[model samples]
Structure formats: structure tokens, C-alpha cells
Target: MYSALKAGFLALPYLSLGALAALDGHCPPLGPVLPAPTQPSKHEAVPAAAAALRGIIDQVTATYNGSAVAIGVKSIHESKLLFEYAHTPANKEKRGAQKVDSDTVFRLGSLTKVFPVLALLKLKDRGVRLDDPITKYVPELRGLKKQAREDSPVWVVDWDEVTLGALASHMAGIPSDLITDIAPFGNLSAYGYPPANTSRMLGCSGFFGTAPCNKTAVAFFEHYGQRPPAQVPFSSQTVYSNIAFPILSFAVEAITKRPFAEFVTNEIWKPSKMTRSFTTKPDDALGFIPPKDIWWDANLGFEGPEGGYFSTINDLHRFFDAILLNKLLPPAQTRKWLKPVTATSSTGLLIGQPWEIFRAENVTSDGRMIEIYTKTGDLIAYHSILVLIPDYDLVATMLLAGPEVSGSAMTLMLSRIIQTLLPAVEQAGKAEARAAYGGTYVDKATNSSITLSLSDDGPGFSISRYVIRGVDVPSTDPGSTLPPATPPRLDPPMRYRLYPATANSGRQTSWRAVGTRGTAAQVDKADAQIVWPMASCLTWAMMDRVTYNMGARDHFVFDVERGKVKGVEAVGYGVFMKKEC
Candidate 1:
């Protein structure tokens, strides 16, 4: 397996740092922060943050109507479990309910969607392309017929044009679900609805309390292949579809010649060390299965890839850790996999292959926002949330089970925890930065110096003073009107901010300083054309704008030994400076 993966994906074209820079506006490159070697790592044990979080958890669980709520948080890169909390309702406790813990298992619902994507990505080793059409694998879907919809005009859905990539990203324009859930078979007569308008969709699985609704790949194509297009294939509109992952799973089985569940267990679950996770419902009593719940035993059949998997908070943390640590796939593929494929209606939300990404604001002291990659799952009585903050190398998981459990309630609990946790994370990161990188650096031969310090008003280090060759670099601007390259002259000093550029991070850490200045348009125009002009607070537009000798004038490379900052090399000026403080 290692040889196959090395030959397949490791040889694929690498996504350069330039590709990541393209997402500068959405997710600013802050680079992954490493733990300090000499100092005790705050992420290893954030006692204050944990204590505050426990308070919030207790407050939430006090009013929680569910039988159990289990939450876990970890530092993905460090592989450290930061915090864990569990709660069981008092009434359920009196009735002898099982104790809830981080290891308590609960249904994963749509979070199972992410596993199919990972499976397909690994199948890339066998020459499977994401752009390959579904018909290429499942030939039964070749001659699909179009049907008319009651809401829209008759439109033919060209199934041949739909690619696996589109399906995974929610861009395939497929129906949300073939059966519309078990609502059609529900008791609509009690709600004054006529039986003529409602009927159970054959081959569509639900909580019907019948035998397992297992349908083969052929049956799925026969029932859903001819359905009318939800929209045009590959349109900009994102339509949530449970039908997509099943198709992906079918393609997986077709390509691997193995059952989807078996392949996932061998390739993903076992490898990630998710011991309690399962595609098929376990017959044991370990799971938090509420008594007399019909939906608990309802088999999802072919739809297992979409919303049928069960996992514990501990298992989910392990899975995310595996992804972040590059245990399952190569680092490049993992980075590419975690990114968004398309934008959604909301500015803060985005759609990945199977991830429902959200961008959080005001996460730091400087009011800088961080992008959080997340996937939410929901079933009849179980709800789950998986959060990945790549910026901080953090992962948080929440699993809830019981009749009173809800998606909104779970979301609220997670939000409160994050709101409390981020401040502590930011404080710790700042402390580490100050200890390692914050101080004055001097070149004794040239009598040049640069002082860097952390500020409460910004995200990265601020250059308080910079002197190079007896010329104040921060207070001088290279005259653009000069015939060619010339020495910078005196001008008003501009504050330069330093941010981590991860692409250059390995043996030596790379950081880029962003200098803000009025753009040509902003300087010429008297009236502002936009509410927030480019010069207000957008640092991305100003980065790398001033280059000298084919290198960024503001780029700095640090020499770190065992997580201790020894010195820095000014790339553009080609000068070495030793730490003075």
C-alpha cells in the first residue's frame, strides 16, 4: 500500500505556495504555530481554558434534555488531548442510564460523507480521477432519462456530464434525496393530508421498522438515475444532496471490487485508529442507543456513506489527527483535500468536497478572523459536529444523543466552547512568539538593527524600529519616479507587520512583513468609491509589493534550533543579524 501510494499521489503535481496565496483574502496565511521546546506547551494542558470551558459545559448540560452529550478537543499537530467533557441527564441517571464519556459512541449521520471522499482520494493511487464521470464507473447510469418537476419546467439531466468531483462538492445538481426521507410513509392523515398525494419511494431506506432496506447499485440507478435535474449540472448553486455520496460509494465498490463498508474499515477506520467507529450498526450495547427508538436500528443500506456511520468523540479526534498529521495521505494531498471547492450563499460559509466550511471572525486580540473547516452530522436522535482550526492545529468534536438532542443545540454548545477556548489559545501563542521571536536583532559590522514586538492591536509582530546601512528602511520609500533602481529617501514611517509564510517553513521559519501604503487609486481619488477601501485594513494587497533585486524587500528567514529562535536573515538585503535581547 505504501509503494502504491508513493508511486501514485506523491508523484502528482504539487500545489505551490502561490496556490495558497490565491486564498489570501478568504484565509490569511498565518502558518501553523509550533510548540515551544523549552517552555511548557500551553496546548499540552490549558488549565484555565479547560476550567472556563467546563463552566460553560456545566451551564449547557444543566438545561440539556438529551440523555448524553460528549465533547472532546485536541491539538492536532501536537497530538495532545486538551479537554474533554461529558454529561448525562439527571432523569436518565435516576433510571440507570449508561454513563456518557468521550468514548461513548453515537451515530455520525452526514459526517460519514467525508469518509467517502477520503476513500476516493486514496483510490487515486489506482488512477482514479476526481473529474471522472459517474457513468464511467457505474455504466447502468449511462442512459438516464429526464423527468418533469412540479416546481420547474421539464429539463433533461445529462448524467454523463456529472463528474465525481462535482458530486463530492455539492455542485452535481442532483436531487437532495430520492425518497424525500420517510415523510411520505409517515402518518400524514393525522395532519389532514390525503393518502393519494403521499407514497413510499421504493428502494429508498428509512425508519419504516421493516427489514433492512438494502438496495444494490443497480437498484439505485434504476430508481434515481432518471429523476429530474435539481438544477443544471455543475451550476454555481449548491444543493445539499444525500444521493451524491452513495454514488461515490458505488463507484468505490466498482473500482475496488469490494464492499464499501469493508474498504472504508480497512483503508480509513483501522488506519486512523478509530476503534469504536462502524459503518454497520454494532449488535453490542456500547453505543448510546436510546431504548425503543425505531430510527436507531434503521439500516441506511446504500446510503451508509452519507449518514449511517457511528463514532465516538475520541474516534473522531483520532480521525482528524490522522488527517492533520498526514498519516492517511501525503501532506500535499491532505492540504488540497481540506480546501474549499466552491463558495456558498453566505460569505462566511464555503463548500469543500464534503466539508461545510465556516470562517470565524474576531478570534484573536487584533480582531483577525480565522477560517474553520467543519462538517456537521444529524440523524433522528443523534447530532455531531467536527471542527478543524488549521491555523492553530486544533480539532474539536461534539457528539449528542437522545430524543431532545438537536443540531442547533449542539452547535450552540460548540460555539460557546470555542469562544472561550480561542482567547486562551491566542494568549498562549502570543506568549510563545514573544519568548522566541520577539526582541531586537543587530548587525555589529554594519551597525544596523531591527526591533520586533507583539502588539494587542495586531495579529503578528510589529516592526517598532528598523535601521539598515544607517538608512531608516521603515521611514523611507523608494522613489517610483526615479529612472531606475535607486536608494530609498526619507518619508513618513509606516508600520510593517510580520506574518508567517508556511511554505518556506521547514528547517528555517519564514516570515513576511506587510507594509501598508496608499494605492495609486486611493491617493488620486478624493471620494471613496467603496465603504471599505483597499487601504483601510487589507494587508494582503500590500504584501510583496516592494521588491528589491528580485526578492521581497520585507521577507525575513529565522534560524530556529530546537524551537528557540537564534537569529534572522534578511533575504532582500542579504544580511545576517543576531538576536540582541
Candidate 2:
């Protein structure tokens, strides 16, 4: 049932924008939003937020007894790292264990899933379509026959029906692995299975714990694709399959006629200046290896596409920053690629192109839900998480490694940091907003003015008063001199709130005022509640409905100088309102 809802939601035009801004229309009643900050401070929240996060890291590391931990907080808006933390066990120097820092390398298990999708996207200009089936490139997969079972009709996945996009998004219905519970260096004879007569048992059954498999990309796909599917393709079910990513790499290899490693290193890592990242394990002197597992280095021949890469905090930061800033792909494609492709049964959880998105509710003073996009990677000894909060242009990265540190440590640290940092960021954002945009602007030449201010309980700046050439913009004029027999010329009251628009250039930004009017039967808190056809979400009906001379009446363009507002242009009226006391 939820699958159907997801499908319908995906069908909507501009869903990426709509889903992110779904709550923007729900404005706080005039006086009850967030309490406006009295003064805007410079990085006022960074030191305290960093301290709180460091405390969390200390607690988690002590509890888990981890050998190394690194955390980074960065702001994409300012292109700066707000805070960074690095830690190692106290007695490390006694035994000569290398200390960890932002540049230290750590294995990024399934977080490597993003690379295949990015490679495919880069090859889009080469006539590679994500909707193309796997069989189109590697035709050998078509020869895999389904098992004949008396009770089962569908015994294996129909590779013909699966597309690259579905695989990247975890909607391809592939099983997680080819061999279940088969260790890299273990014997199946103890489990009651007969000893193999050939080397197939030793070579074919090996997984992450064992040496790299000797199979080629095509052979690996043929071996894995013959298994029974976890769900039907495009069923909107998210079954995380590590093998799915390798299949995508197979597509990339077939298209480019080059090895996946070479392509990724040259195109992605090198271009983004990710110096410490590697598809294979780097030297011990270069990487931070735990004491007990110091000699643990296994090559992932086929699994390299999924859990085979190693990266550092600095490299990963550069990677995400480049992608988010549209330095890698075009802006339109980047925006579309970063959104959720399906929703899970959990109301707060959604799935993107392998992204585990969480909707954090009530994190801010205004009680606005913030959407956080995250990708977590867990391996034998290392656990890492990369979190992107698109709303505020913030990112939180956590990486941990040790025998005692489990994947839960990453989760704990991520949750704690988000809890501590978001509120601080929200406060900082509000303070900055108030300082830059909260004030009165007047056109001295024409005696026109608008008073905009932030409230303790509002989502945006509220227009308390607006005037244009002696005409009240928000008041009901209704042409008082109209003929008596004409229509009553009723004009309903409008409450205005100004929000930042998507159009931004260098030092200028565009803000639009959205006015909400009382309906015939209005329920203030139930604005999202709907009967049928979603009647309550008709905010579009009231916006830009009345335009003059191709300029929207609600449009206000702010000219910024050094991150502070200089003046606001009322585009509809062709007037510039200079900032004044």
C-alpha cells in the first residue's frame, strides 16, 4: 500500500522541490513563531556545539573503547569547516600506534555505493540511460535459467526487467548476497554439508572475510543474478543488496571499455582532490590499523564496487562538497539526484539513490521538521556515517574504528551530534536572518515603505506594514469610487510571510512573500488534514495569481553587500527601498 503511494508521489512534477518545501506553507500565526534573536553574533554557536559534540564523542569512544575517532562539521554555504575533532587511545604512543586525524584513511564499506551511480551519471552524455536493463550491456545474464521447483513459480530474478536506476536505488529486488554465511576462509563440512570434490567450494563460497574472488565482472553478475529475488522489481521495496552496486559497475565497465577502478580514480577521486582515498587497501604506515587487526587487508575483486574503498574525513568532505556545490554535475541533475526515490514503512524514513533519509521533526524552535540525508557504512572493524542537512547547508561526518567499536557507536554519535548541532544551527540561522533582513526599508523619493521583522514564533519575516505610492498593498482598497451598481469588489484580508526563493546569484537573492487568507471554513492546525483531492494544500491557488507587467506582486529582490542586506527592490512597482533605521 505504501509502495503505491510512493509511486504516485514520484509521478508528481518537480517532486524534489515540492517534497523538501512541503512544510513551508504552514506558517505560524503572526506572533507565535520563533523568538527573534536580539543580536547576531559571529560563529556564536560553534564553540559550544563543538564542545557538546566532543563530549558525546568522548562518551561513545570511552564506552566502546575505540582506537580512533574523527568528526567534522562543515557549512556548505560558507565553504568552511565549522568544527573538527580527532581522537585516539591515551596509551597509543607507548606501543607506537599511529594517531588518527582528519586525513587518516578508513575503510568506507557500503558508502562506496554512491560512486557507481555517479559514474553512470557522468556517462549520461555517452548515451547511457539509467532506465536501460542490465542485459543490454552484459547479455550473458540472460542465459541464467530459473530453478524448477514444484511449489515455486518464480525462482530467480528476471534480470531483463531490472534497470540501472532501480539497482542504484535498491528497488531492483536483488538478494543481499550470493552465498549465505559463507566465510572467506571457512569449511562447510562442519555445518553438515558434504565436502566438495573440487576447488569450487573454496573459491566460490568466499565473501568479505576471505581473499578476493577471481571471477570477472560478467562472471560475478551471472553467479549472483541467478539467486531468488527478495522482492519484485519496482515494487517500491528497499532491499539493500551489496551485489547490486557491482552490477552497476559492470554496466559502467561495459560502456567505457575500461576498468571501474581506473575510471573512478581518474574521474571522481583525482578530480575532486581526494588524495588518500583508494580502491584497494593502502600501506599500514598510511592508514590507521587497529592493534589486533593490524594485518587484516583483503582485496575485494568484485566487491570493490560496493564495500572495497578506503577514504579519509578530508577526502569525503571534499567529495560531498563538490557534489552539493554543483561542481561535478549540472545544477538541475544534482538537485534531482539528491532526493528520495521511495519511502519506507517508517514515517520518518525514506530511501534515495542508496541514501537513508531521515525526517527529523521538531528540531528547531519553530518546530519545523528538517530533512537529513545520510549514508552509513559498516565493515569488519570500521563504521562510518556521512550526514547532509540540505536545509541549512550543513554536514556531519563521523568515522570510528576498533575491535570494540560497533556500528551502533556511529549511530549514537550521529544522533547526538544532530541533536546538539541542529538547534545551534537553527539559532544561528535565525540570528543571521534577523541581522541581515529584519528591518524597515523606505523609498525616500516616493514615501513608500515596508516594515519586515522576525517574530519569536514565525518561520519567516512577517510584513507588518506595506505601502506603495500612498496605496496600502495589504489593505482592501476595492476602488472606493466605483459605480454603485458594480459588483461589491470584495477583497479579503491577507497575512504575509517572506521566504527565501531558489533564485540566488553572487551577492543578490530573491525572496517571495506568500500571503495566507482565511478560508470559508478554516482550521488553523489542520491545514495539512485533507478529506479527498488534498483540498487544504492549494497554496498555489493564492500565489502569483495577480501579476502586473510580467512582474509578480509578491517578488522582492534583495541586494546584499558583504552578507548584509543593502536595499530591497520591489520589482512589481519599479522602486528601490533603501535600508533605514
Candidate 3:
């Protein structure tokens, strides 16, 4: 969610008018609902509440080689400003002095998918069903088939399952390789390459390349349209690829009959009064001139539906405000956007339409459950974080420009800041509960698993499991006594450290697991069978069966029935589960 922070002249020297002006066109004005303070306070004094956060930013900037940073937060409850800050390097670059402020815009990278989601909802509002097939809108997909062989012609394959919903939710089963390219439009041999070599390179370049050049996308579809069906499943990467966005952009354009950027500006940005937001042109007033730096040129341009746009923190806060207020999209649609579409094990975060759903800890004044909606962006040399606390009506966004910023590192930093700052707003009054539920649990009936392990010898979490499938087994001679069972050789466990949730409370959970070592090569030779512990398996079994009590904070209870874990209830946080060896 975006925050609304108007640029105002302050008395402090550090808070100069130039800095304020730098923020003017970048920061959005406070929403109408925000209550004005009876008296304005000094802006220079660092609040004790945000001290830890400031320190964190300083440390991250120093560690990551960042040249500039900007941060903003807003309270969804009252639409009031929670905090905002911008910092720049003491040394300047040659082209122009890099000055960061609330208004300074940065390429949002993959965050562009959120806008397409909004567009999809808008289409839905106009009586378009997500279940409708792509062919329904773009007839080109009709009769489209994959080639059986390299020299074969395309043959039709059923695509009834490739629905609009699947495309938006990333279940459309479209291969990442299907993108078309629209680049190197002039002479083919301009780069001193043979015409044949240039043609060959162009044909295969679709599978590679950093950005989704339009020319490449077209070339890919032309040559591979007759190839075998796409095999990759829906994933976060699918949402970020240039291939996915052009198709989505085409759909939006076809539906609205307007340029994608223009439609977004009128339909979402302007109406929401996100004055600083733009998907097409960079804001010159905020110094977001194109081609000013290599990073900027490489990152920003014709905004794609997947991840091409720029905005200030305040503008993003406004965008979030629109979501919470049910202004841009209906409440039901917004909920759909935030709902978990799939489970992501790699990060242990639930994947929503375009958002990542995190079950946060340390929420309410009295410990209670809270949900976090988050998304991160990584471009050439920039990293950004956007997180929303639904229960607390809080939104936080950070953008850093540098040569070495990474999404993972930025997220780690953001998580730390939120954990430290959340308490000041409203403390989650739950006591430090017992650490009884700290160990791993397993369930044999469901054949599922989980493992909970600590990090830095400190409290943390990770997930470890093997997905079992039915397979043929060799039969042993009846007379042959089973060879003496031998214990399976184990390997050193691999650890996945958990980030504590930023919400008030619900499940303060974490995970860990053992790495694949001797399992693959020794499976056939091993005699003794490996099995997961009951508690861990039970948790996995109950995932879909149990009705989780978002309000319940009781002792860690694992309900097992018929040899499978049917339910789990844990106080403070859930126990970690590990897969059987």
C-alpha cells in the first residue's frame, strides 16, 4: 500500500527546501480521511520508535553498496503518515547529483503485474468471466497447436483449461518460452554478423535475453507456435517474464481498446489521485529522466503488464489505500487478489494473485493473528519492498538504488524493520510462551512431513519434506530371509531460517529440513525403511482438512486419527515439521 505525504517546508537545515521540492512531485498528498494534527511537531528529531529502523537502513545501505534510499509508511486505519525518509550518498555521480526524496521514482520491476490484476478485475466488472478461454478474447489462440516434431506442422491440442483465471493466477500452463520478440528492427547484418547467423541467433534469443524486447516475443510465437505443448507450470517467474506481460497487455488493450499505459493512468492512477504514479513517462520534475543512468535506461521504458512502472512511496501508499478502501476494485475482487492462489514452499509464503501472503507474528496489543501482503521488485541495480499489514491498517514501502541490491537482502532488511517498529503502534500483549512446540513432528498415515530447526542457535524456522509417489518395487524370493535391515546413512541437515512475521499474532511459525545427500544413490541398496515422525506428517495431513482457528492461541496440539495428523493447535506459534529420512 502507498502512503500520502505532502512535501512541506520545515525549519531544520537537513530538511531543506530543495529536499522538500525533490519530494513534491514524487510524494502523493495525504488522503482525505487522514486527520490533521492540532499542532505540527519538529521533523528533525529522530523518534525513538523508529530508531531501530533508521539504524537498519543505515546498515543495509552500507552493506549493500546502495547510493540512495527512500522509505514511506501509512496507516490504513486512518490514512495517516506513519513514517518517511530518504538518504543519498555523500559523493555524487558525474551525470547528475543523485538525490532521493519521497517523490523520486524507481522502476518497480515485476510489481507491474499488480496493475494487470487490477485491469483483470476491471474486465470482470464489465461482465467478463475469468474462466473464459483466451481464444474467446484473442481468436489467434484458437486452433493453435504444438508441433509433434522439429519439421512437423502444428496440430491442435485442447486448451479448454487455459482460462483467463489461470492466466491471471498463473495456472494457464503457458510455457515461458512462448514469448515473441520485437527488436533489432533494422538491417539484420548491422552488427557484422552473417545473415544466417543473425537469423539463427534471433530465433533462439527468445529463450534468453534480460528484458522482454517486443520483437523477440513475436519471433518466438511465430517459430514455436507449432511446437509441442508448453511444460512449465505456473510460478512467480512466469508472472515476471516479458512473454507473459505482452499477452496480458494485448488482452487489456483489446478489452479497453486503449493503450495499456493510458488506460491505467485514467482507470487507476489518476482516479486514485496517485499523482506521482505513471506507467508510461518518467516524471521529470522528480528527476526520473530516462537514460540518465544505465540502470534507469535498462529498467524503465514501455511499461509491460508484468513489471514495468515507476512510483514514489506516497503514490504506492495511495494505491494500497485504494485497495483497502475498495475504491479501485470491489472488496470481493480485492480479497481475491490477496487470497492465496497456490502454496510456495521455497519461501514458506502463500502465493496470492500477485502478492505474497505472510502469516505474521507479534500483531495485536494482545497477541492475535495478522496477515501480511507483500511484494518485492529487483531491476538492474535497484531493489524495493512493499508490505501491507491488513489488521493494523499499515503499509510500508522501501526503494533503494544501487549496483548491488538484491530482493532477498532487501526483504530481510524490511522484515527486521517491521518487527522492530510494529510494537510501538500497538503491542501484542502475549507473554513469551513455552518453547514446548519447538521440535519436529510427523504423521505416517498421510505420509507427509515437516521439520522445525533454529538458526544462529536462536529462534527461527524451516521446512523439509519429500513428496512421495506410488512406484513399482522389486519382489523378494519368499524363501530368502530379508537381508538384515541396515540403517540409512544420513547427511548433515540443511537449514532454512524463518523470518518472524510482522503482524500482531496468529502463528509464529518457522521451518528447517535435511538436505539430499545419501538418499538418491543409496535408496535401492538400503534395507531399513525411512519414515517421518508422527507430528510432522500429521501437520501436513491436516493442512487441507483442518479449519484453522485464526483466533486460537493454545498449546501445540496434534490431533491424530486413523494414524494421520487430523489437526494441529499450537500456542504462540506452530511447530516445525520435517520429512522422513
Candidate 4:
């Protein structure tokens, strides 16, 4: 998901901050009931942690050819700012040395959408239904009859099923960019003339050129307001839309009457004391998400609610903390804001309001899995991510100022940083009873999913099974929009013997690839057909090589389902696999 090949998941440094993570919470929580982020221990390892973290940033900048980066990591469980690093190249082509800090402002890219979604959720809390037709608020979207043409450029939205919830959750069938509606992988390169993803419609130099643009993002909205819908009905796929949020802004404005920025400022920012946060004007912060690595002069009249704000780390942190801490929204509203819109998504993770619901694999000492609610924002010049470990009361954020030349360089850096700084959840105490956590829970969301075989060491099942590749990437390029050939045969499953508490001599799980099996890569190489007793040992050899160091460690999440094992989240080589029955 972070643009790294699945194989990249296995290559992180073998450092764990588990013991250090047990340190008492020195930082304060975002709210009263929430736990504070874990503070750095006075255990003398803090210096090493800082050094290693800085070294990683230095290495990443060097390899990735970045201009500057600002990163901050803290435990949301506590209030301490554990680590902060800001670096800019010494000699930057006549652009003097820039040292960013907590006060520095950053262009949040699509992350700006979270603010409108927050406003929407606040309205929802006040009895505004998400299921209401979008036209109810923005009357401009009413009664636009479409006449089919032999060939047309601009497409209209299906005004019928376009609900507030669908638009908010990115299921409204809206195009991703205001310019080009589609930029699917392989169909187009990320950097073509007038690339759809990061085209700046701001100043003269906005659209990868010097001459100022004659139009603004407003034109697209006006045209779409009267355009015809695409051929397909609006359902079944979550298309990330830059235009949808602005349309949402229109809906929000119709409800509030005041300007969107003013409404947010008066309603959310000022109340939370996020004084530095802004949707317009007087932001002199040196940080910039330059479009195409070319800086543009300030022109707020162009870019609108889609992504127009420049914010600080602490301010954005405060914004999220306010939501979590119940300063901005109540617990129920916050939960609704973070809930995924499953009707429009196929992946395990999907959008909640405007945030993404993503969980990685790892267990607490008590064998509980941690769920990380997160959002990653990427502009051409800036890249940022906010990861919330709700269970551990931790929030990790990273913002980089430079071109996202490859992809998600910040994601990889932040991932390593999270792993290095935050300790794995304390392994749960073991039970002498076999199959203590064994149960049959079904996850219809996925097929050929985890099938448990519970046995009794005492009254219950005696042992467990474990599987290789906690996450399975088919070795086929995901960017291709091709149809599947045939479903691969389900191989025999391996059960885990979860680590026990009272037993000092026993280990939780082990692996044995007992039978002949082919990996997705091997099958794809053979035209989606598996050869019995496969002659090639290549795939297995590679898998063994990959897993020798980075293997799956299983965790069972309880709070998710209660009283039952519910499901198993497997982590291998940085890949997280969901195996819930």
C-alpha cells in the first residue's frame, strides 16, 4: 500500500522497542478517557533511538533525493513528543537553508478533506443524516437532463444514488482529479504532461508551467454540475475523488450559509486553539508542497476546499487529538467518522468519512491485536501520513517537503520509525488449556479465509495451526484492471500453537511446508494453473529465503468480536494478513 513491493515488507531493520514501550505514560491523552502516548524511557536508550532515527532520515533523503523532511512521533496514550527531526540540504540551489520545526506549516494535500469530513460528522452528530440525497443541500445538482453524444469529454454524475454518505466515503462514482477523471496505473504514468493526480491549479506556475492558469478549480465543478453521468451506475467501487470533497464543501456551505473556511475556523480551529491552522492567507511557513518541484506564489483564489490549507504538525495533531479526546466530537460520532464504507470497497481497508481504516498485524502482551486507524496524503511536492494506534493510544505522523519521486518514501520511513520506536504489544499470558483461543468465526468479506481447527489440551482443542505469508500478494501487478483467470486451489492450512503463559519450555508456533505447493508467482508463470508436485523449487526457495528472517507472528484481537478468538492477524515480512474465520 505504501508503494513498496510486498517483498519490501521483509526488509526492515530487526529492532524492536517492546521493552522500552512498557515505560509509563508521561505524555497526556487527546481526551480524558483516552490513554496518553508512551514517553521515551529515561533508560539511556533514548539517545540511541534518536541517533538511529536521524540516521534513517539522513539515509532516506540521500537515496530519495529529497529537499527537506519533518517528522514527529509521540504516543497518543501520553502527551510527550518522543522524537522530532527536521532536515534540509545545506546547499539548495540558491534556496537558503530551511530548518523546519513544530511551527512550520505544510500543505496537507488531500488530507484537507478530513477537515470537511469532520465538519460533516459534526453536523451528523447534530442530526444531519449521511444518507440524505446530496441534492437536498446543493440544489445546483438538481434536474440536469443528459443528452448522449457520440463522443463527450466531461461526464456527469448519476444524480439518483448520489447520497451524502456516498460522496463523503468516496463511493459517489466521482473522478479522482478535477482535471483527468482517471489515471489508473499502466494506463498512464504518474508524470505525464498535465498529470491528473498532482496538477496545481494555483498561480501562473501552478500547472507545471510559468504562465498563470486562466481558470480555477471552480470551473470543473460548475461544468460537472451540469454534465452527464458516466455510463456505469454509481456503486461497487470507491474512487478517491478530489472533486467530490469540494462538491461536499458546496453541500456543507448550503447548510452552514457561511464560507466553508470561515465555518471550519469558527467552528473547529478557534475552539480547539489550533491558531496556526488556516484555509487561507498569511502563511509564511517555509514548508511548501511544490507542484512538480516548482514553487508557486500564493494564490488562494484558485485551489479551494479540495486541498487549500497549510497546517502545522502540532496543530494537525491537536485537530485529531481533539476528535479522539472528545474535544471536537463525542465518542459515538468519532466512531462513525472512523467507520469504513464497506459497500463500495473490496480491500480490507477503506475510507471512513475521509480517513482510512487500516490495521497492521501485532499482538499485545495479553494477545490482543492493535488496530491502527490512519490516513496518508501525497501531493507532488509534499507527502504526509497520520497513523493512529487506537488500542495502544499512540499516534504517529510524518510530513515530508520534497517531490514524491518514487512513491510513499515517507510511508516506508514512518513505518520503520514506528516499528523501531513502538514496542510490539506485550504477548498475552499463556493458558495451559489447549485451544483457549480457538473458535469458528466467519469473515464473509474474504473468501478462502482462516479456517480454525480447535483441539483440547484440556477441555478444548490441544494445539493450533499457523500459515505462511500472513499477507498474500498474488505476485501479479495490482495496477492492471484485468479479470482473474481462475481461483487458485486452497493449500493445506497450518495452525498455530499460540504462546502460553505458564509454560517456560514451550513455544507458541512453528512451521513446516509439508506438501508440494506453488506460490502465486509460480502459478502466474504457468498460466494460472498449478502443476502437481511442481518441478520448480524456485518459488519455495524464494519463500524460504524471504521468511527465514521475517516470519509470521500471530495476534488475536478480542475487542473486535468479544469472548471469541474472533480472528487472527498475521505479520510476515512487514505484510499484514487478515485471517478471521
TM-scores, one per candidate = 0.86, 0.82, 0.58, 0.59
Give the least accurate 10-residue stretch of model 1, judged by summed lDDT.
13-22
Ranking by TM-score: 1, 2, 4, 3
TM-score of model 2 (CA atoms)? 0.82
Question: What local distance difference test score does each model get?
Answer: 0.71, 0.70, 0.49, 0.49
Encode model 4's per-residue lDDT on 1-581: one tens digit a residue. 33343344234211110011110201111111111223334324544666777787777677444456677766554465667777654433233225567766676666777777777767874567878878888755643334223234345455556887777777777555534333322235545644444332322323333332222243443334443443233456566776667777777788888788888898899877787777763434445433334532333233356666667778777777777778888877776676666543333365677677754533222222245677777556666677776644566777666653323666678667766665421111112121334444333334323333323221112223332333232222111122246433332222122231111212233222111123335334543243432222221222223231355232222222333233444333232234343
The sequence of per-residue lDDT tens digits that candidate 1 reaches over residues 1-581 is 43563344223321111121112211234444333222223544366878988987887678765457888877764555778898866444232237778877788889999988899999988999899998899876655452233334244556688899999999988777764444446677787766643322563465576444455443365556446778877788888888799889989999999999999999998999989898888744667765445556778777788999988998999999889879999999999998999987888899999998887665655555567888999987888889988777778999887776789988888788778886677667777778888999999898788998865455577778788877787656452222235554434445456777765465688888765433334332412443533223333443554456877677899997776788888887777789975
Best by TM-score: 1
Candidate 4 vs. true structure, TM-score: 0.59
- lDDT digits (tens) for residues 325-409 of candidate 2: 7888889989888888997888889898878898866666566556789988987777888889877777778777777777886
Candidate 3's TM-score reads 0.58
Per-residue CA lDDT of model 3 for 393-487, tens digit only, reads: 67889887665556776777677767766655432111111122234555444443434443212222333322111110011101112222542
Q: Clash pairs of candidate 2? A: 32-457, 33-456, 33-457, 33-458, 34-456, 34-457, 34-458, 35-456, 184-210
RMSD of each: 7.7, 6.4, 18.9, 16.0
Candidate 4's error at 460, in angstroms?
Answer: 19
Stretches > 4 Å off in candidate 1? 1-45, 91-97, 146-153, 181-200, 217-219, 479-491, 517-528, 531-542
What is the alpha-carbon lDDT for the whole of candidate 3?
0.49
Q: For candidate 4, give the lDDT.
A: 0.49
